[model samples]
Target: MTQAFEGIRIVDFSQVLAGPFASGQLAMLGADVIKVEQPGVGDQMRTTMANNKLADLKLSPGFMGVNANKRAITVDLKHPDAKEIIHRLLADADVLLENFKAGVIKRLGYDYDAVRAVKPDIIYCSVSGYGQQGPMAGKAAYDGAIQAVSGMMGITGTPESGPMRAGYMPADISTGITAAFAISSALFRRTHTGEGQHLDVSMLDSAMTIMSPNLNKYLATREEPALVGNTSPTFQGTANTWPTKDGHMQVSVITDRMTATLVQALGKPEWADDPRFTTSQGRVEHADEVKALIGDVLAAETTAHWIERLGNEGIPTAPVNSLKQLMEFPQLEHRGILATVPAPPGVEGELTMTGAGFHASNGEPKVTSAGPRLGQHTEEVLAELGYDAAAIQAFRDNDVI
Candidate 1:
C-alpha cells in the first residue's frame, strides 16, 4: 500500500542527530529523502562507535539509528559550482532541511530565500543551537550543553549526583522529533494556503518546551523542586525505584486508591489506613518514610515476584531492564518497533533498525534500506539529475561533488 508521504521529496542538507533524525522520519513515512553530506568525510556521527555494533553494520550506531531509509550523496558545498547542484536538487523537492551553525547556510548561499527561489512551495527548515538571532545564537551547542542551559540537567538525577544529564541525550532526540512534527504541520498547512515557509528550530527552545510542565509549576508556586533521584518531583516517593532481592523494580502509585493497592501488595494492609501515605500529597510530604517502608519490604523478594504480585493487584510495576535484556523483550516483537533491512556494503546479514513508533490507519511505517555509505548514491543521483559522463567528470575534476 502507498504510505502517507509517498510522493513527497526531501532534499536533506542536515547531519548528526537532529536534522538527519527529522528527515529519517520522513523517509519512514515514505517520503523520498536525499541526504546531502560533505564529500569524503561525511557526517561526524558516521564515526560514533556505539559499543562495537559498527563492525557488523559498516556505520556507527548513531548514524545507523537516524540515517536508514534514505539516499545519501556528498557534495562539496564550499565549491563555487556546488550551488548549481544544490539548487538543481531543490528544483523538484517538496522540503529542504539543514542544521548548520548560525549564519552558515546563508553564507553557503542556500538559505530559505535562495532555496525558495528554486522551488516556490518548498518547506525549508533550519535547526541550530538557538533561534536565528539571540545572545547565544553563535555559540556551539550539543546535547549536553543544551541540557545544562535549559535546566533539564538541573531537575534530573539525585541530590547527591547534583545536576546530572539524562542517560541519553533527550535534547537532540526531542528536537528531531519536534522538527518532524513542525514539518508535517507545515505540509498540512500548504494544502490550504498554497504557500511554504521557513522554520527556525532551536535545540534550546525545544528543550524548554519539553520542560514546560515543571517550569509552570515552579512559576506558580515560586518554589524550586528538589532533585530526588529516580523519583518524579510531582509525586516524590509514589513514583520511585526500589532495590529488590536480585536487582531493582520501579513502581508508581498515582491515586489514593492505587496507594492502597500498593500497601496490600507489600503485605502492609494496616499502612493503607495510615495518614502518612494515604494521599498523593501526603506521600510527597512524607516521601522518606514511605520510601523506606516500601524499600524494606521490596528487598525481601526478587523483581519477578514483585512484578507478578503487584501487577495482579493492578499496581504499575516494572523491572529495571538493561539494554541487552530489552532487546529480548517479547512486547517489542508484538509492537513491531524493531525491523530488519538489507545490510549496507560489507555488512553481512540483514540489519535491524528502530521503526517509527506509531501505526497509520492506512499503512504502517517502514525502513526500506540500511544506512548508506559515504556518497554511495552519488553517481546514480547525479545521473538522474541529468549530469552525463562529461559534466560529472568535470564536477569530479573540480571537486564540486
Candidate 2:
C-alpha cells in the first residue's frame, strides 16, 4: 500500500523539540524529510543529554525520543558555496521548515523570498520563541519561559503552593502540533493554487491559544479560577482521587446513576438522600464535607478493590500510573500504540525508540530510517541534488559540508 504523503519532500532546518517534532510527524506521514544541520556539531539536542556516566553519547534517550524517520545532512550555510547546495535541495522540496530566530534565514540569504525564487510552490514554515514581529520577536524563549509568560503556570499547581510550571514541555509540544497543522493546511492549499506561503509559528502564540478559554472566562466573569488540585472546578465535589489500602484511585461520579452506584458501592447509601450532598450543585457547596465523607469510606479499600468494584458499576475511574507502568500498560500494547524501531546506522540497537503515534487503516506508517547522526547523509543528499563526488569532496575539504 502507498503511504499518505509518499511524494512529499521536506527540507527541514529545525533543530530542537518543536521544529523537529513537527517535521518528524510529517516524516511519519511519509514525507521525505531531509534534516539539515550545521557541520560536525549537528542539532543541539544530539549532545544535550550526553552525560559522561551514560553508556551511549549519540544515542541519548532524549534525542531518540523526538527524532525518527528522517535523514540528516550537514551544510555550513555560513559558507558561500554551501548556499548553492541548499538552493539545489530546495529546488524540488515541497516544504521548508526552520525554527531559527527572526531574520536569521534572511541573513543566511535563504529567506522565503529567496527560497520561493528557487521553488515557488515551497511551503516555508518559520518557528520561533515569539513571532516574526513584536516587541519580543527577537527575544529567545523556551517551553518553561512560554509557560510562565502565557499564564499556564498560574493555573497549574495547588492553591497552597501557589503557581507552578507543568511537569512537561507543554508549550513546545503544543506549538509543534500547531506548526504541523499549519504546514498540512499550506500543503493542501498548494495542491489547489500551486502557490506557496510563509507560515510563522511562535511558542508564545501557541501557548496563548491554548490558554484562551480560561483567560476569556476570567475576563468575562471577573472571577479567578483557583487551583483545585487534581479535580476540575466544574466537577469539584463529584471528582477526586481517594486513597485506598494499597494505592490511589481517581473516581468520577458525574451523573446521578453513577453517584448512586458509588454511594452504594461504598456502603454509605444513607449519604445519597442527605440534603447537603443530594445534587451535584449542593455537593459542590459542601465539597469539603463531601470529600471528607468519601475519603473516609475510600480509605477502607485497596486501589485494586476500588477499581474492580467501581469499574463494575460503570463509574469512570483509574489508578494514577507512573511512566514505567504507563509504558507497560496492557491496553496500549493491545492497541499497538507502542513499538520499537531500529536505530539509525552507526547507532547501537540499545538506542532504538518508539514509532509514531498515529495509525493508518490503509497501510502501516513506515519507519524507513532513524534520526540522522550529525552530517550522516551530507554527501548522499548532495549527490541526490546532482552534485558529483568531486564537488562534494571539495566542499568537505573546505569545511563547508
Candidate 3:
C-alpha cells in the first residue's frame, strides 16, 4: 500500500531539531524530502554529541536519529544564483519547512509570499522560538531556554531540588511533533480549498501544550502547581515512587480497589479497611504515615518482586528503568517503536533510531533510507531538476550549490 504522503515533495530548509524532525516524520510516511543545508557546515546537529570519528564522518548519531529517509543538498541562500535554484525546486514542491528566526527567511528572500508565488498551494511551515509575530519572535532559543520560559522547568523536580529542566530536549521534540501535525493539517485543508497558508509554530507554545494539565489547573484555580516529583496527582502516599531492595518502582494505587490489592500484595490486607488509611481523604491526611508504612514494606522486597506481584494484582506499577535498562525492555521490542535501517555510506553496521510512535493498519510509518551524507545527492537532485552537467558545474564554481 502507498504511504500517507507518497507523492508529496518537501523542500526542507531547516536545521538542528525542530524543523528537520517535523520534515523527517513526513519523510517516514513516504514524502520525498530534500534537505537543504549550507555547503560546508550542513546542520549543526551533524556534530552534536559526536566523537572525533563521527564528527570527521559528518554523521553524528544524534543527527541520524531525527533525519531518516531524506535526501541532502547544499545551497548558499545568500548567493545570487540561489534564488533560481530554489525557485526551480519550489516550482513543484508541496511543502516548504524552515526553522529560522522570524524575519530571517524574508531576508533570504524565501518568505511565504515569495515561495507561494512559485507554488501556489505549498504548505509553508516555519518553526521558531516564539512565533512569526511577537515581541520575542526574533529571539534565538534553544531547548533548555524554551523549557525554562514555557514554565516546564518550574513544574518539574521536587521542592528541595527546586525547578529543573528535563534530561532530554522536551521543547525541541514537542515542537517538532506539533509542527508535523500542523503541516499535515494544512496539507489536508489545501486538498479541499486549493489554497496554501503559512504555519508559524512556536517552541514555547508547544512546550506549554505539553504541560497543559498543570497550566489548565493553574488557570482554573489561580494556584501554581506544586513540584510533586514522581508522586501521583492523587496526593496519596501509596501512589508514589518507592525504593525497593534493588531499584525504584513507581506505583499508582489511588482507587480503593487498587489500594486494597496493593495492601494485599504487601501482606497487609488489614490496612486496606483501616479507618485512618481507608478513604482517599484519610490517606491524604495521613500521607506521611502511609508513605512510611509502604516505604518500609517496599524496602524489604526487590523491584522485580513488586512488579510481578503488583502487576498480577492489577495495581498500576512499573520499575523506574534507566536508559540502558529501558533498551532491553521486551515490551518495546513488541511495540516496534524503534526502527533499524542500513547504515549510511562509509559507516559500518546497521543504525537503529526511533520510528513512528503509533501504528497504522496498512500504511505504517517506514524508514526506506538512512540519513544522507552532507550534500550527498546534490548533483543527482539538480540533474533531476533538469539542470545540465555544465550548469550544475557553474553553480558549484559560483558557490551557489
Candidate 2 ranges beyond 4 A from true positions? 50-56, 350-352
TM-score of 2: 0.94
Backbone clash total for model 2 is 0
For residues 52-94, write the lDDT of model 3, one tens digit per residue: 9989888998888788999999999999889999999999899
Candidate with maximal TM-score: 3
Question: RMSD of each candidate?
Answer: 1.6, 2.0, 1.2
- In candidate 2, how many Å is residue 46 off? 1.4
TM-scores for all predictions: 0.97, 0.94, 0.97
Cα lDDT tens digits for candidate 1, 21-109: 98888889999999988887788888776556574343886688699888989899989999888878988899999898888988888
lDDT of 1 at 198: 94
Ranking, TM-score, top scorer first: 3, 1, 2
Model 2: lDDT of residue 278: 74
Stretches of candidate 3 above 4 Å error? none
Clashing pairs in 1: none
